[model samples]
Target chain A: MPDDNNPIPHWQRQDLPPMLSRRFEFETYSETRRFLDGVAELAEAAQHYPNLSFGKTYVSVTLDADGKKVGPDLVALAQQIDSLVAGTP
Target chain B: MPDDNNPIPHWQRQDLPPMLSRRFEFETYSETRRFLDGVAELAEAAQHYPNLSFGKTYVSVTLDADGKKVGPDLVALAQQIDSLVAGTP
Candidate 1:
C-alpha cells in the first residue's frame, strides 16, 4: 500500500535494486546545473553519495540502500534532495 | 581505419547514436565532483552539453552529434574534456 503521507513523494522505491530513484526535469541547463550542485553539497554533508545521470535539462538520481531494505537515512536523504527544488523559483 | 593521431583518443566513437563517449575513473568522490564541475564550466562556455552519468568514483560522458556524423566541434569538446584531467594531481 502507498503511504498517504510519504515524506519522499518524488522518488520511486525499487525493491530489486533496493534503491530510491527520481528524475528531475528543468527548463534550462543552468537550472539543472544548480540542482546538481545542490545535490553535491547535500551528499558531501550527509556522507551519502548517489548515482546521478543528467543531460541538458534533466537529472536522474539514484540512492542505493546498503542492505536489502530501504532505511530511514536513505528516506531522509531523498527528502533533502526533494527539498533542493521545493519552493524554488 | 582508425586514425593513428586521433585528437580525442579517450573517447570512443559510436555510429548508431552518432556520439562520442568516455568514462573517467577517480579514486575518490571529491575528485569525481571536481571533474564534473570542470565539465559543467566547460559546457557553459562552449554551449555544448553532454550526457553525464556518474557514481561515487566514476563519470561517463557522452557527446551526441547533431547530424549523422561526429563533427570537428564535438571532437574539440572531447579534447577539452580530456584536458580537464590531463596533468592534474
Candidate 2:
C-alpha cells in the first residue's frame, strides 16, 4: 500500500467530479485482461471499487470517494492498483 | 441482437477516437456489480471487449472497433451491452 500522504504522480487529478483518473497501456489483450483481474481482486479485498474500463490494449481507471471529496484514501488505493497493474506481466 | 443498421439512441457517438461511449447509472454497488457481470458475459460471447468503468452508482462504457473505423459491428455490440445492462436489476 502506498502512503496516503503521497499520491502517485502519473494519475491525473480531476475535480469536475472529484476523482483521480488514469489510463494504463498494455501490449496485448491478455496482458490487459490480467491487469483487470488484479484490479478485481483489489476491489474485492478493499470493498472500494474504482470504475475500470479496458480496451484491447489499455485499461482506463477512475476513482471516486463515494459522494465525498476525493481524499487520500482514494489516491492511495489508486496507487496500490497502479502497483498491481505494474506488477502484472 | 439489434439490426446492424440501427443502433441504440442513448449511446453517444464519437469520431476523434472512432468509438461509441455511454455511462449507465445505478442505484447501488450491488447493481453496478451485477451489470458488470453481465458485461463480462457479453464480452465472452462476442469476443469483443469494451472499456468498462464503474463507480459506486454508475458504469461508463466505451466501444472501439479494434483499430478500424467505428463500424456497425461496434455499434451493435454497444447496443447489445446496453440491453444487457438495462436488463440488470
DockQ of candidate 1 compared with the true complex: 0.90
Candidate 1 lDDT by residue in tens digits, B1-89: 76889997778999987999999999999899899999988888889899999999999999989656999888999989999899853
Error of 1 at B46 (Å): 1.3
Candidate 1 chain B, which ten residues in sequence have the lowest lDDT sum? B1-10
* Predicted candidate 2 versus true structure: per-residue lDDT over A1-89, tens digit per residue: 55566558678877777888888898987787778778877777788878776766888888876678888788778878889766543
Off by over 4 Å in 2: A1-19, A65-72, A86-89, B1-7, B14-18, B65-71, B86-89
Q: What lDDT score belongs to each candidate, Candidate 1 first? A: 0.91, 0.77
Judge candidate 2 at residue B64 and give its lDDT.
Answer: 71
**After superposing candidate 1, which stretches have Cα over 4 Å from the reference?**
B1-3
- Tens-place lDDT digits, model 1, residues A1-89: 76889988778999987999999999999899899999998999889899999999999999999656999999999989999999853
lDDT of 2 at B4: 66
